[model samples]
Target: MTILRRLAAAAIVIGLGMTALGLAATADWRLGLIVNFRLQLLFGFMILVAIMIAVGDRRWLVPAVAGLAINAILVGPWFGFGLGTSSGESVTVLHLNLLAANRDTAAVVELLHETDADIAFLAEATASWRRRLRLVEIPFDVVATPGDVRFGIIALSRIPVETRVLGVSTFQLPTPLLSFDLDGEPITVMSFHTTSPVNTRRDAARDEQLMALSDLVSSVDGHGVLIGDLNATPWTPGMSLIEDAGYQNSLRSSGLQPSWPAGLGPFMIPIDHAFHSEGLEVIDRRTVASSGSDHLGVEIELAVKR
Candidate 1:
C-alpha cells in the first residue's frame, strides 16, 4: 500500500508537470521534455487513472479529474462537426508520410493501388520512391527533384495537376502547392512537411515555417486543402496559427486518429493532418494501415459547400 501510494504520488506529480508543459510550452522543448500537447494530455490522464486504480486517493483524484474536464472542454472543438456541411461535390484525399527509411516499397505501392484516391500526397518521397512509383501503373504523378536535401514531396492525381514548389521554406524542403480542378471548381492543395520540434533549433524552425505557411494559407482566395506530416498536434501553437488562417482542421470531426510511431499501439501521436478552407466541408476522415512506415496514412473526404 505504501509503495503504491509513493508510485501514485510520483505519477501525479509527473502527470501534472507534463500537463503544465503542454498548456504552457507546447512549442518548446523544455527541461528535456518535448511538449507534445495531446500525448501529454493523454498520458497525464492515464497516470491519473493508474493512481485511481491503485489507491483512489481523493487528494489527487479531484484535481486530476478536474484537469481532465478542463482538457475536454478545451479540445471539444478539436474532435467533431468541423467547418460546415455541404452537398455540392465530394473528393477523397489521402496523405501518406512514406517512411523514407522503409524498404517495403511494394507494400506502399499496394496500399496506394488499393485506396484509389483522387489525389495522393506523399512526404519523404525519395528518388527510390520516385522510381518505384514510376514502375507502377499510377498516372499523372509529380515527384520533387531531390535538391540540396535528401528526399522531397510527391503527388499523384488521376486528373490534371499543377505542382509548384514553395519557395518560402527556410530549407529548400518546400511543401509543393498543387492546383487541380474538382467538379468544375478550381481547388488548390498544398502538401506541407515541417521539421519535428525535437529540440530548440528544430522547434524554432518549425515555428517559423508554420507562420510562413499560415500566412500563405490565409491569402489563398479559392477553396484549398492543406495536407501533410505537420509533426505537431492540432492543439499546438503552430496548428493554432494555421487555424487562425481560417482553414478548419479536417480531422477535427474524425476523432483522435493516431498517425505517428505506428508501433506504439494505442499510445501514438497524430502529427499528420489535413486542413481546408470555408469553401470545403470535411464529410469523413479515417487513418489508413501502416505500410511498414512509422506513420499511417491520413485519409480525408471533403465536399465543396454549395
Candidate 2:
C-alpha cells in the first residue's frame, strides 16, 4: 500500500510539472526555452502515462484519453487538410520559402506553373533566383527586391497591378510592406519575415518591427492582408497584438494549422500565416509541397466581399 501511495504521488507531481511546462512553452518569449519546454512537456506526459501503467491505475486513463483527444483536435489539421469553403471571388495566393541554396530553378518554375496560383509570395529570394524566375512564362507581373543575407521577399500577380508600394517606414526596422491594387479594388498586402527571437539582436528588431506593423495595419484606410513567415505562432503575445489590431487569422477562423519545419516529423509549428481585414473572406487553405527549405509552403485562397 505504501509503495502504491508513493507511485501515485510521483505520478501526480510529474503530471503537474508537464502541464506547467506546456503552459510556459506557450507563454515564454525566449524561443530556445520555449522549444525545450514543449519537448519536456511532451516527454513528461509520456513518462506519467508509463508510470500510471506500471502502477496499474485505471483512474488515470480518463485524463490521459481526454488529453490525447484535445491534442488531436488542436493539431490534426496541420497535416495539410482543408477546413473551409472558398468564396466565389476566390483568388489563390501561394506563400513559399525558396531555400536560397537550392539550385533547381527550373523545377521551382515548373512547380509554380503546375500550381497556377493567382498570386505568389516567395521568401529568401536572391537576385539570381529572381532572374531565373523571370524566365518562366507565367502570366504575371512580378515585383521583387532580392536580399543578400536575410528577409528577401517577392510578390507576383496574374491580374494587372494598378499600384505597387514598397517599403513604408516601420519604426526604423527595414522590413518591406508591399501593397497592390487588384481588380479595381485596392488590396493592401504586406509580406514580413521578422527577425527570429533565437538571438538577441534579431529578437529586439523583430519586436520593434511588429509594433510598427501593428500601428501601420490599424491605420490603413481600406481592406488589408498580411502574410509571410512571421516566425511566431497565433497563441503568442506578439500575434495577440496583431489580432487586437482588428485583423482576423485565416487559419484560426478555420483551424490552427501548423506550417513549419517541413519534413522534420509530424509535430509542426505554425510560423507562416495569413491575416486579413474585415472585407475579405478565406475560401480555402492548404500546405504545398516542400522546396528544400526548412519551412513548408502555405497556399490560401481569399475573396473580396463585393
The alpha-carbon RMSD values of the candidates against the true structure, listed in the order shown, are 2.7, 5.0
Task: Provide TM-scores for the models.
Answer: 0.88, 0.75
lDDT of 1 at 183: 66
Prediction 2 TM-score vs. true = 0.75
Location of the lowest summed lDDT over 10 successive residues in candidate 2: 31-40
Query: Model 1, 1-306: lDDT tens per residue?
Result: 768777767766766666666677643456323345554565567667667766867777766776666666666665665544676667788889888888888788778778857888888887777778778765445544444457777877765677677665666565677787766788888888888777899888887888887887986768899898988876677778888889978767676777888888666777898989877887788889778889989888888777
Please list the residue runs of candidate 2 whose C-alpha ends up more than 4 Å from where it truly belongs after superposition: 1-55, 58-87, 135-139, 146-151, 163-165, 168-185
Candidate 2, 32-118: lDDT as tens digits: 335423333444455556666776766775565444444444344433333445335556778887877877776667667877577
Native-referenced Cα lDDT, model 1: 0.75
Return the top candidate by TM-score.
1
Model 2 per-residue lDDT at 62: 53
List the candidate 1 regions with Cα displacement exceeding 4 Å.
31-34, 37-40, 43-56, 81-87, 143-148
